[model samples]
Target: MLDTDTIGYLAATFTTTAFIPQAWLTWKTRRAEGVSLMMYSIFVVGIALWLLYGLLSHAWPVVVANVITLMLASFILLMKIVYK
Candidate 1:
C-alpha cells in the first residue's frame, strides 16, 4: 500500500501535470482569447497562497506541486495579459 506522502505525491503529479497540455497549446498558438484573465489572475493568487501554506506546513508534496503549478499558471497568466 502507498503511504500518505506517496499518495499525496501521486495526486500532486496528476494535478500539476494536467495543466501542461493547455499551457502548451496556449504557448504554441500564442493566443489566449479563450482564457479568462480574471479567472487566471485569481487562480495564480490562490496557487501562491497554497505554495506559502505548503512551505509553512513543511509539506513537500504540496510545495513541489505548487511550485511547478505556480510557474505554469503564472506563465499562462502572463500570456493572457500579453496576448490580450
Candidate 2:
C-alpha cells in the first residue's frame, strides 16, 4: 500500500506539472487572448488558499504543488493583463 506521503507526492507531481505546457506556451507566445481573466483570478486565489491549508497541515507536497501552480497561474494572469 502507498503511504500518504507517497500518494501526496504523486498527486502533487501530476497536478502541478499539468500546468507546465500552458504556461510555457503562454510565455513563449506572449499571447493570452483565449485565457479567461476571471477564471485565472479565481484560480490563483484558490491556489493561495490551498497553499495556506497545506502549510497549516504540514503537507509538503500540497505546499510545494500549490506554490509552483500559483506561480504558473500568476504568470498566466499577468500575461492576460499585460497582453490584453
Best by TM-score: 1
Model 2 residue 23 distance off true place after TM-score fit, in angstroms: 0.7
Candidate lDDT scores, in order, read 0.94, 0.94
- Candidate 2 has its poorest 10 consecutive residues by lDDT at 16-25
Q: Report model 2's TM-score to 2 decimal places.
A: 0.95
Per-residue lDDT tens digits for candidate 2, residues 3-25, read: 99899989998998898898999
Q: Can you give the lDDT of residue 7 in candidate 2?
A: 97
Backbone clashes, candidate 2: 0
Cα error of candidate 2 at position 37, Å = 0.3
TM-score (all chains, Cα) for each model: 0.97, 0.95
Clashing pairs in 1: none
